[model samples]
Target: MSSRIREQLLSLLLEQGDAFTSGEEISRRLQCSRTAIWKQIEELRKEGYQVEARPKKGYRLVHRPDRVAPEELKPHLRSQRFGWSIQYHSQVLSTQLIAHDWARKGANEGSLVLTEEQTKGKGRMDRAWHSPPHSGIWMSLILRPTITLAQAPQLTLMAAVALTRALRRETGLDIRIKWPNDLLINGRKFCGILTETRGEQDQVQYVVLGMGINVNTLEDFLPDELMKVATSLAIEGGRTYHRVTLIASILQSLEEFYDAYLKQGFEPVRILWEEYAETIGREVRTETSQGTIAGMAVGLDPSGALLIRHQDHLQPVYSADID
Candidate 1:
């Protein structure tokens, strides 16, 4: 269904409150035939909306689903740019790959690639990310920032800060950023972010930020290896969360931080990241491709690299898993 007609139908149902609105009444209000109204109602049902239709009572809106479809998010989204253009998929290989392809084809900045499940989702260092159907938030955002290639890494920290703040506000959980782009709650991982950029020399053409969050994933759905280290909002909070609301909140937070970083600098993002960082001033073991380095996590550099005070000098780490 077109967003306009869906919006009109939802508005009519919402305006009616507990009362039922007949198909003829909706047809006249939306300026469509009764058949069209029925079809739209079926579409709404397919999207997880509960619409009750009786012989005489007509149609009544019962419940709204927690899906992350465009129509579901349009009514809740508050951003001016981010999430304005969304490519929603029920299942895909990876949102990062699709977003990168769209970015290369000149897709607009702030365009979002969202999926309910990913067959081959990956994280930093090419690790498979478990994305169960209708249980997690697996998305990638296409950004055409004018920042230099060197400054692009800060976007990962920016996303971490945004996701941290959004989850804190929504779930009231004690969320913390673990290095480059991981969110932990009570020392268990719940979110991971991977950022990919394509550029040359000092200029950056575009960046695709992939985010996978375990929202309503149950314990049985997780792999045996991940069961100990990973967790979900439902497990932590003892309830399921509405994915649409969380997505809208994260998009708004991202747009706010992205604009701030562009106009001001990385200082604002750095400060916010530090406030929510879980690695600072702790004994950490960073495992990079070269080898493992164990030291005290001092802080972050201006460019968002993890700074580890390894004995004599402070070493800057660009990529690694903190243990």
Candidate 2:
């Protein structure tokens, strides 16, 4: 049950691959008893790993769990910092909330909080995001960038670009960004990004970039209300993908874009975002808290706000839904 022993056991299984490793060999290698090895194997099975035990041959790792465990991801992750330290949970109210706490406690800038399921996940305009277990990527990244509060919104656009590239490369699907922070495919939404910040008027302390991606969710698993407007990669691509691979790709892409944004400013990120935008040069209805404005989608302004050309003037919409 101890993390150290579990990790040691997992490392041994991974090293052996399909070959079986005897209990005595495992205990001697890990400096533990056969009873301790057995306990760890049971724990691995509880975590969804399929470990097979034979008469005298010993244990062989059959299949890894579908869930996104830190051990499963650490091997594939290449990011220097973004995914270096991960806080994983089987289920939580929201990864965003946990990330906020971690940021307040001085968690590293690139540390990530990821969960297999979210019971009360949040979205734009106080909407509820449905995050079923093992069906989607519900994660939040802690960022402590030295950017002004006005420039924080640009991070959302940067995330959209990162996710767009990652999804395109992974699924080979035509993934596009629906202005502000939604990722769409074939005019249906499959991902949403919410960037929350804590700071003074002139400076930002930290930003929590939360992302919800429906990766391997089946069509029938979706709620009836969401069937019209929402979809999953599995539904669109006709297959399920390895969540750990997608997560690794997303973190690598995000760190690349984040570093570029820090060194070169927002111009580079803005250009990349524009290339994948789905709302430009089309008619859109933007619903703000004040009211709804329907017009032609022009482009993004300097501050990353959506530029909508109304009847006779251009309006910059800071936050709204594109319909």
Candidate 3:
């Protein structure tokens, strides 16, 4: 079955929520025959959609599984490119590992690899990312943008702004960005971004932008030590959201910001980042390779470096574990 048909069928059933749509009506609306509609409905059943079918009444969507697979996400995606093609896994060591392979193999921009569980997921500074099965969004998006190597780090900050906008818009939670790549609410973390790029001397070849979001994870799923610093949207929002819907929103937001960045440069994205940033105008203690640097967090330089004011000197930090 064509993916487009699957998307259209699911969308139709969802739009008519709690109402049974007839087979004849569905066929007419989709411009397909009754046989085709029935076949597609069967496919949906296999994909975990609880569709009710009667003799005359066509189908009613009873339940939609919270899966970020193509069937679930593509139906909600309105972006022209992002999420147009997707790869899903039930379990993987890391989405980043597969994404890197696909990037080298010439995966198109916006090709996404997502999974229900990641056994060995990682965050910045080599810390382990706790990814529970079916409780969060763990994925890597492949992007082949027309940007230089020096500007690749900006992708991390750009993604921070994009996801912040998406989460705040979708869930209405008060989320803020933590410098280069994390999102927090009420001084606790719910999302992290890890951007990896392969490039020539001055130009980028491809970027595998990885995102790990804690969405529906309940408090019991968290480790005892993580309860203080880690949290999920479900916990903060006091309810669960459809992971597929959130994924679609994030993809749309990323694509929008990405297009703007390509045309308008980092100035616009930087402004948005500052608006959502929680690290600015605060004292920061960052651990760099050279040594620990304690300074007052001020702003970001044009290239997306965190500018710190230490006594009389302004320092730009490219990579660090900031507090």
Candidate 4:
């Protein structure tokens, strides 16, 4: 209810595109109290929107900030389905987990679950993701595709490709995909992608594409252990960037690449992914449940599995803990 009201208020103000709006007029139109309208106005201000209030004039949206509200991001978003519907939480245990639950309850395809801060956020292989308050992009995308379970793994690579393209356009960061899903800049970890799916034996019900990118994380906020290994957009780009814009770009690219993948197969995205991939043709080591393997990263199979060229053998690694 509040979400609808907030969106409606934004739309009204955007349509008006004037200096100010009267409380009486807005309250009557929204079917809410003037106090309720004022509170929502305050909420928008808190999210970086510059809402100017006057005793006689009521409220005026002076500037639309670059936070990731559905309405604020709507004009910038270019996706047909991805992020068309969004659920934003100020703080949550995990957006990915919440997205999974929402998907189970029949959320639409490309529904976004996002949070400013994640308390129990996780990464690939149950690793704890460091998400400081309002410092990064901690979000999950719910994608319900008409594909077999085998094709699910390809989505992570697709996301990496999409995210890389966005970074290139937005920040112009020299980013690369580190094999399976990690995004790197200047040989350091800048982003991570984790793909989890829930479905039946031969069908995929919904897949959660969880992506975490260090946008503006401060050195003080990071754990002492990760300060050396992790890098943020602020660190790499040397400037502060709006997370909302980056997210909108990512969703747009994801939608484009996804549609192409569905029609033409992974060949196109595979080419793009390989071009930006840093791990391919590099000497690396990865840890699997079985053991550690030292090999040369050849490329990805059609299923998005890593093909490692070990001594006297070529192997397809299903899952690996990249080192």
Candidate 5:
């Protein structure tokens, strides 16, 4: 079945909402033949949608799988750009790798690549990200902004602020931004954002922003070391959450903040980021490629670098591990 017809069929079933629609009515509504409708219904069943067919009443939607699909998310999305066009996968090596290729092939500005399981998930410095199957949010967004290359780092901070705000409102948990990219809960890490740009010397062609969030993973299932340093919303909030809903909230929030950051400049987003930042005004030890620097975390610079107040000089760190 064609992608267009597949989506329309699911949409119609969902709209009917427990009530069965006759085959004649569906064919007339979608302008397709009864044979085509039957094929598409079978396709939906293969994709995990439970559809019931009866002699008199044609089809009824019974159950929608827990997996996140664009058809399932369209009704919940409020964003104009983000998540409008999506590439969803059950498993992949990394969504970032696919997103980069999609960007090069003329994918939309806000095209998103999402995966339920990532076998080789990546973190900062190529560190392994513990992404269990069907337990976390492993996704990437392709962004083609008009900002200069020098201003790209601010996007990471802006995303951190957007996700932090949305997760707090959705989960009702205390989540804080830890320096450049990580999100913390009670001093334990819960989320990480990675931003990579593909461009020339003076221009930014596009950016692939990858986000990994531990939503419903249980704490006891994690490794010993990860249990000490990592946590999830289910663990912190004492309950599980629907990943589809969380994805919609995140996309909506990021698109809102991203539009504002572009029109109003980084100052506005910076202010909001500082509001939920746990790194500011605290003593920190950062391990940069240059060396390890331990000092007081003062504020962020214009380019989104973390500023540290040492002996007498203030230093800006572009990338580091805050220990």
Candidate 6:
């Protein structure tokens, strides 16, 4: 669906400033009915905006808060492919599920599916992701790489490197990667990445990289069960940072890393990924479908498969539960 009209409606509302304009004036100016204006305004409210309607005085934009609306974020986005077709939702079951469907239906590579909140969001290993309504950045990037399926794991590592670079540049908060695909702040979890793919053994049709970041969310907003395990940017930085800037930074970094990976292969990206990886060279406990493996994390192979140096030999861990 084209968000241009809704965006224009939002822009007109924002341009009017604090002046209370009549609904009839808005309808005449935007060439729409007062009811249409009222409906869109209510939709904006559902997306975490604060608009005030004072009797017959009409609608007043009390606040133009940072929302995932295309109008609010389009100006800040600098991607050529990523986010070119941005989808915004007030609340959804999962952005990953939406992105997967879009990809299957021929959504362009780097197309973004974002929601202010995700009701059935997912994390690594089909875990339930905590996406509070209108509190964090829930997004999924649809990527169609021409690389072989064997090389697909590199994309997850590549995403971690890209996100680390983006967080450092945007929030100025030192972020690190925890092994495969978790972002850490001060040794605590801040972000989780779930990379799901659909393809054959030698070729990949498309890949969905879903990232759930705790942006301006407060500690109290999270459940007590997660308070100690999960953290947000606000908790780490002690202030609220703009979500648009974060999104733009991530796209830019992802584009750069993706370009490098496509041209130079995963060697360079893997080196950078390892530099930011908190699991490398650290003692870790890994759980996989086969069983569990405890060893000193050596690093990653050229194919982005993690290398765990166990008692008698170096084991190539394709996928595992990391600790």
Tell me the spans in candidate 1 whose CA falls farther than 4 Å from its real position.
1-4, 14-17, 287-292
**Candidate models: Cα lDDT each:** 0.90, 0.91, 0.90, 0.86, 0.90, 0.85
Please list the residue runs of candidate 6 whose C-alpha ends up more than 4 Å from where it truly belongs after superposition: 1-62, 288-292
- Candidate 2 has which clashing residue pairs, if any? none
Ten-residue stretch with the least lDDT total in model 4: 65-74
The TM-score obtained by model 5 is: 0.93
Number of the predicted model whose lDDT against the real structure is largest? 2
lDDT of 5: 0.90
**At residue 177, what lDDT does model 4 achieve?**
86
Clashes of each: 0, 0, 0, 0, 0, 1
Let me know the TM-score candidate 3 reaches against the reference structure.
0.91
Error (Å) of candidate 1 at residue 144 is 0.7
Instruction: Give lDDT tens digits, candidate 2, residues 1-323.
Output: 48778877887898899999999999899998899889988999998889999989999999987878887788789888998889999999999999999999999899999999999999987799999999999999999999999999999999999999988998999999998899999999999999999998789999999999999998889989999999999999999999999999999999999999999998888778888999888999978886888899888887788888887898899987678
Of the two candidates 2 and 6, the one with more favorable lDDT, higher being better, is 2
Candidate 1 differs from the real structure by a C-alpha RMSD in angstroms, to one decimal, of 1.9
**lDDT value, residue 243 of candidate 5:** 89
Per-candidate TM-score against the hidden true structure: 0.94, 0.93, 0.91, 0.88, 0.93, 0.85
lDDT-best of 1 and 3: 3
Cα error, residue 177 of model 4, in Å, equals 0.8
lDDT of 3 by residue, 135-157 (tens): 99999999998899989999999
Worst lDDT 10-window in candidate 2: 1-10
Question: What TM-score should be assigned to candidate 2?
Answer: 0.93
Off by over 4 Å in 5: 289-291
Better of 1 and 6 by TM-score: 1
Cα lDDT tens digits for candidate 5, 1-323:
47688888888998999899999999999999999999988888998889999999899999987777777777778888899999999999999999999999999899999888999999888999988888889999999988888998899999999999899999999999997899999999989999999888878899999999998899787778898889999999999888888999999999999999989889988788888999999999977777789899888877788889977789998877786
RMSD of 6: 3.6
Candidate 1's residue-wise lDDT over 1-323, tens digit each? Answer: 46668867886886797899888888888998888888888888888889999887789998987678776777789999999899999899999999998998999999999998999999988989999899999999999899899888899999999999999999999999898789998889999999999998899999999999999999999899998899999999999999989999999999999999899999988888889999998999988876788899888888888889887789889977778
Q: Per-residue lDDT for 30-143 in model 4, tens only?
A: 999988887888888887888878898877778976456576677668778899888988899999889988998999998998888889999988999988887899999998
